[model samples]
Target: MKTKFKIIIGLLFFSLTTFAQKDQVKILKKIYAKEIITDADLVDYKKNATKYGDVAIEEEDKVYSEFYKSILPILEINALGANVTTMQKANFINMETISDLSSGLNGTLDFEKKTGKKLYTDKINETIRNFKPIFWEYVVVLDGQKKYKEVSQAAYLIYQLDKKDLERLYIAAEYALRAKEYDKSIQYYNELNALKYTGESTTYIAKSKVNDEYNAFSSLAERDIAVKIGTHTDPKIEKTPSRTGSIYKNIVESYIAKNDIPGAKKAIVDARLTNPDDTSLILTEANLYLKTEDFDTYKKLITEVLAKNPNDADLFFNLGVISSKSKDGQAEAEKNYLKAIQIDPKYRNAYINLAVLKLEGETKLLDQMNKLGTSPADSKKYDVLKAKREGLYKSALPYLEKAEELFTGDADIKSTLLNVYNALDMTEKAKALKAKK
Candidate 1:
């Protein structure tokens, strides 16, 4: 009889577990079916406020917040085991919310245009704020389940809903990049580039002033004077969005990450085609050539760019680098380095290179001095050579000191500066630098 009772107990426990799972699944489905807040819903809430009073109206207005809350349980359920049907249902819910919010935001914007009043601004902003957190939660859930394609899709939806939201666009592009969906990432980055040029315009409506009529009837003929004061008649002004240049850089990087050098080149070309006069894009193209080791192309491109904008310090610095790398370019390198420093006094790289060039010259002079014999006549010659070498070393002092001041934590710079200090007989400064590390 005891054995029979144990069997019955086990069967009851199994039945309870099965029923619990079914109930959880039912809740998940119900959450998915919850209606998303729409423009019409907002309108209804406003229209019915008088009939419903403040409490009922407030409850009705919590539709979006409530919907987001409803999905949390399903997200929790999916985190454990993640039933396929439940996951699909959650994605559907996300898609629906994205679509509804996007449509509602557009409609609200249109209403503002017509009414000249920001009626739904706060509501839309609140909904977006609520949606963003929950949207990220869904992304985490999908990403944890290794549903990368779904994650990208959700990210793309968020971007479409608010193209002006650069953070969302960047997240979408990064997700696509991580999934090896290079084409998708490129598309998103291109969209970002397009939207970057079309900046948001803000409009403000000014209130009109009222006029009062004053009459004096003391004389035979009464005269009425109309006075208008504190009236605002200024027209609404719209400010265009500022142009941003980093999107092209992002696109090029995405292409390079996929080992598509030609694609990166083409992206720069396309950006230039649109923004021919954009110096930043031209500089980006120059950098692309430099990265690929096409020195000739980089030089030619930068030369053309410099002709247009010669005051650019970075361009002068790049020219200095190119000159420094050439076979017989000491003089040219020095000229370019000096030019860069003249344009920007705080140019640390220019200072470092100038100092290194002087140091190299001093080192060669020292080598020649060391090669001299130890005879009395040779000793006299060595003294002259050593004096010349010391002068050359001293020439590097100002630049090296400036470089050290500009960048304190660089070990290479500090080491080079220490060498310079020792060569110039500045023992105190060298000891101080050595004590730092």
Candidate 2:
């Protein structure tokens, strides 16, 4: 009967030991395998390394071992990660000597477990503090070269970051890019861009597009790959951070690139905060509106600048360009061009433009002959001026004839001069221009 009682006691002890090990193991495995963790994990991972005040060598060993067992594989991973980072490496290496501590703990635990010693609660607590299994998962996945690892790391990093860390998200993007997970990197980059954290919005968007192009180009090889993927057109991105006084500038550039002149102007108007004393922004705003044929904003902004500075050649030029672009542009275009000439007589474009305008009507080419006055006559010049002043050879022939004096041997001008003669109702001159060649 006594022997039977002792056998029961031994069996009960064995069962208790088995249950204890299994319970701890199950707890960890469940937390790890499911890959879901609680806030407590984050809190513990952030727990201080200097928690035990003046710990003895044996106590420190006990503490390290306990942390290793309870933390699963996360603590060492973080230390390595922190160490690998900028300047964090120097501090991390000198901070606590992680490798030795971890090894000592594991070795001590193995020894203790073999001898059937009681498991300490402090280690479990430390492990609980050292939460962040993604850290370990990252190492494992990277070490094993798992395809999903980089994307997974990026997602976790994004989740872990708060407001202050939006910029650091670039690191996660690097991993995602390296993994060929272009979409995920874009997500992070786009998020950062949206936060207005750094650089121009279009800048980041441009970078993203470059990455997309590289990726698409790498995957395919065809002459029309750009046209095929429509990769030539950049995908739109949300507004991002801006440089001081450059928000509107950036938006304008983005619109130009997208070929949305009207949209670009609208963005400028919407975000139009300009220097108070300077109406340059107003002039810019007007020019953009004029490009879109939005006459109201164009007149309003340009007029405002002109009112401030009447002699403003830029505003006059702006008005001239707008006038010329209008449907009934002839009259207003002539008026603005003259005004520009009056303001800056030496404005080279005004002289050239006036020369052009005279030939548009039934005016003589010699009317504004003084503008092209005396360029040692060349067919190249004649041809260039001829093409530029099309539809009015009556006013252009004299200049062409005069210019042909120097470049009589030039085939291009000689050919154009013949056409000018035909328009000028001078059949004899046309014949003469052709006959010379």
Candidate 3:
């Protein structure tokens, strides 16, 4: 009697567990079968679906489910077109999740157009009416896929939706730049500048496990909780610097591209005032002077930078490049180039430029040789010039060889070295280089 009672209790428990599983499945199926034609219907269905167990619809289904819910409101709005407010449109616009609708919406419109059930323009208007959060979310998704033009369009739409959201204009400027809409980018940037917008924000970050680099969290509380829970390490609250300098710098660059030198100069001065200690602003000013052939000012500004950053090899290289542009400045050019090399022994560009400086006289000598007539005097002169040319080749050889050794993968260096080798009749070296090629 005791054994039978125990068996009966075990079977009853098993039957109850099996019945509960079956009931959950039945509830999930019933929820899926209901036609969710309105947002209210969806809300009811979601409540029922989650009542018995935690059930998530497929991601694609969730997207289309939201689309199905929008249909009734969209049709009603079209029927009662004049009665709707922009706020109503904005609300519905933010209701639908349209990210993963790669082809469904367009296909539906095409079908409607073909059947004459709905005009194409009406469908387009409906889409435009319900365009906000769709466009907003798509901007992020499109940016991730590197679809710059689409991102630009979406960002512009968001800007249209809320002109008061200056951050949207900022984002529009960025995507416009990426999409190569330079004029549009400049327009947006200028507007931000007029508004005196300095885009600065504080971010909560912690070091990531994969790269050990700081990854930002959505909020300070989240970051602190993650750190406290030992999920992330190296918690930090970082304040982003202002974008005023960069905004002005971008304006200056666009102006330079347009060859509006005066505009660039004016913007660069403002940029420097915005960030007085920015080294890049100083460089920009120097480059502007270099562009206008004001070498005196270029050298003075560069000297100022070198005084502050005496160990910078690239600064010395810039001085060398500037001096080498003039015939009388070759000596100074060589001295600065050598100084750059002394600071950074592996400076490939300095080596290449030094070789180039040594070879500069070859062109003049060749010109003089070509102009000479084929007389006995010309022949004697030719021999002297030939000897000088050979000496020039010898002078440049060491620097070229060193540059080649340092940057074997550099095509410019390889081409220059090959030409020098052939000119000097370095048969074995030329052959070796050809074999490598």
Candidate 3 or 2, higher lDDT: 3
Question: Residue pairs in steric clash, candidate 2?
Answer: 44-129, 45-129, 65-105, 66-123, 71-127, 196-241, 365-395
Mind giving the per-residue lDDT tens digits that candidate 3 earns over 60-80? 333333333334334433333
Residue range 192-254, candidate 1, lDDT tens digits: 776664334443433344433222223222211111233433334345454445567667777
RMSD, one per candidate, in order: 15.7, 20.5, 18.9
- lDDT of candidate 1 vs native? 0.67
**Top-TM-score structure, candidate number:** 3
Candidate 2 — which residues are off by over 4 angstroms? 1-245, 252-266, 273-280, 309-314, 325-329, 341-352, 361-437
Model 3 scores a C-alpha lDDT of: 0.72
Candidate 1 accuracy as TM-score: 0.54
The whole-model lDDT of each prediction reads 0.67, 0.52, 0.72
Model 2, C-alpha of 365: deviation from truth (Å): 15
Tell me the TM-score of each prediction against the true structure. 0.54, 0.32, 0.62
How far does residue 268 in candidate 2 sit from its true spot (Å)? 3.1
